[model samples]
Target: MDEERPPVVLVPRGGAWGEAVAAAARQRGLDPVVVPLIADAPPEDPAALDAALARLAAGHEDSAEDADEDGVPDGRHGAPPTGRTRPDAAGPGAPWLVVTSATAVRVVAGRVPRLPAGVRVACVGAATARAARQAGWPVDLVPDDESAAGVAAALPSDAGPVLFPRSEIAATTLVDGLRARGIAVSEVVAYRTVGTGDEPVVLAPPPDAVLVTSGSVAQQVVRRMTPLDPRTHVACIGPSTADAARAAGLPVHVVARSRSAEALLDAVVETLHPNPRTGRSS
Candidate 1:
């Protein structure tokens, strides 16, 4: 009899990626186990964020408006009254979203009473767009090249004043690139990524494959790989994540497209099945 096949393992580095991995695993007929390496929490100081939220709520939080009123570009403004809220379309018009993570979508949905119906959502990856869509908002652009830089470059010229509400620790490369390209952005810190700081989960041994999502996840996986098998296959979402995995000295067997669950599953199928053209074809 053939040896029992080793189970494919999934490590959803964080809550946002967990949602994607879980959905993708179900689609591919695999059982995914979530080893949450990190927790997403609010900022360390709630007072500053609370004050900002109050300003945005009070109708005077427009970055552009503040800039115009001050003549000087960068001085801080006094916080607006508490419990103030802005209209959904506060900017020039309905803005297109520039979302990089699923958490960003949920954060915005939670804070904004109701999203602007006419606003368009643009996501770096399919999973992020899916989350926004599930929340009943219109997702207009899901770029094939999934990254902050990619989405920034792919944005339509007509998309006025793009809104990017993302994690405080997220890379600023995308924002810088968009700004260099002359895209007006009103960015807000919607959430923060916190290291769980929990003792690493003990593993019996690494399975046949390990799925990795973000840089933080890669680092967490490396830290927790003490009981891991040396021969485990490593799969990463994209070039950035693949780089992280390589930095951990693991042989990366998969480099998924666009850092989405669909792409990761496709990469896994291709790795295990080995048909370049049609991964599942025997």
Candidate 2:
């Protein structure tokens, strides 16, 4: 009998996102091994994050305090969020909370459940939006293009200052882009990325495909699992990650059209099967 196909593994660390990736791989008949190459760590200095969150929480409370007995908020509820604090606003001035990743949504929501009145939310993509919704946040903006540049381009230039909570190694694309547009962005480190520090992974049957989700994960993969089989396909979630993989001296087999697990797996499936209706090549 022919040898069984090797399993695929990905992400290194994604939490909920990782689970979604694994499920997608399974649907494609790619049993992926989940070996977290890195883990989430609290920032060494969380004072900045704490302060920002406190202000947001206060604003959330103040907004609630404005509601009448009929539950009609005297704030931006029935009305659209102006992205600026109204003179009679119940809460403190609100800022636009920008989230680019599902992880960011999880982290921020853990602190502030629902956003304060007048504080609009902008997520980069559908997955992140879903996460924010699950966390009880009202996502006000999701760019048609699901990338950092996309978010920066989509946000209104005349809007209020933006409160951006992100990972330690987050790229400067959004911040830089917004800044160049003369928009005020207050970036806070919500979490840190630390190596899981486990010894190099050893697999009897190496993964046929590897999913690279983030730049950090790409680095870890290179460090822990170098000397990959030439036949092993490396799939990146987006162009930025593909750039990182190439920088790390790892050959990238494919870059997903969009930034999602299903997209990544779809690209891999396409590579694996040239024929759409049939698994075999046409």
Candidate 3:
């Protein structure tokens, strides 16, 4: 008789993201049990966000120029004297819209039907970039690193004032980095992360592994689901989240190489099944 496969507990954000993780778990030969740890809702006060969006739109209207037939800047149509194209098409005055998460993109799109023209959109990772593109915004930059610090470093020195819309519990990484570089930053609380207040449902058989995707999720797990089994593996999505898990007294067994769902799943797989000969995941 075949041995029963151990189940993997996934603490994911509800909706499409959660469904995707369930599908990925099946492909990896792990039985998935979803326990949504946190939920997001728009911020209570919309006045500040509304005002910021208005200012950004107004700035664009005041400075934007018409693109040529080829969709290039009018004056700089051909290659320059050095045979190189200009780095940025938006003028220095255009506001830089930096989105670090898909949730942030959704919140911003709900308030502003269309993004202001000429505003440059920068995302922290491929997932956030896809969200912005789907919402009819053109992405200008995606840093090689998925963290806030990485995004800050990738931005041009002369990029204009940044408008960052994020969750209320967001870390200070981006804000601090941008301000240190002398760039003006205006932060809008786009959403709030709230706990469900319901206790986590106990699995018939405890999970073999538990995945932590965010710092808020880590906090909720520690608060709601205390006394985790020692044998269960705790996997984090990245370094910052791993730090949160450790701070909450969770024993982290794996950390993803990148901030993508695929990389995170890879970490879980390696933690659960190391290669026999090399004693490392293949």
User: lDDT by residue for model 1 over 1-282, one digit each (tens)?
Assistant: 012332456665645557766767655644466777766787566465444445434432344444334222132333332232223332232245678888877777776656544455788787888888887777777777788778878875433456677788677867887778766666667788766665766655445567877776677777766446665668898887787778866668889866776788777766666333332223
What lDDT would each prediction earn against the true structure? 0.63, 0.75, 0.76
TM-score for predicted model 2 compared with the true structure: 0.82
TM-score of each: 0.73, 0.82, 0.85
Tens-digit per-residue lDDT, 1-282, candidate 3: 113444455655668888888888777766677778788977888888888888777655544443344443332312222322326545344468999888899889998888876788999988789889999999989999888999888876656568899889899999999989877788988889988777765655667777888888888878877677776778898888899999988889989998877788877877777444433323
Best by lDDT: 3
- Residue pair clashes in candidate 1: 57-84, 57-85, 58-84
Please tell me which model should have the higher lDDT, number 1 or number 2. Answer: 2
Model 3 residue 7 lDDT score: 48
- Better model by lDDT: candidate 1 vs candidate 3: 3
Ranking by lDDT: 3, 2, 1
Q: What is the lDDT of candidate 2?
A: 0.75
Report how far off residue 161 is in candidate 1 (Å): 2.3
Instruction: Candidate 3: give its CA RMSD in angstroms.
Output: 5.1
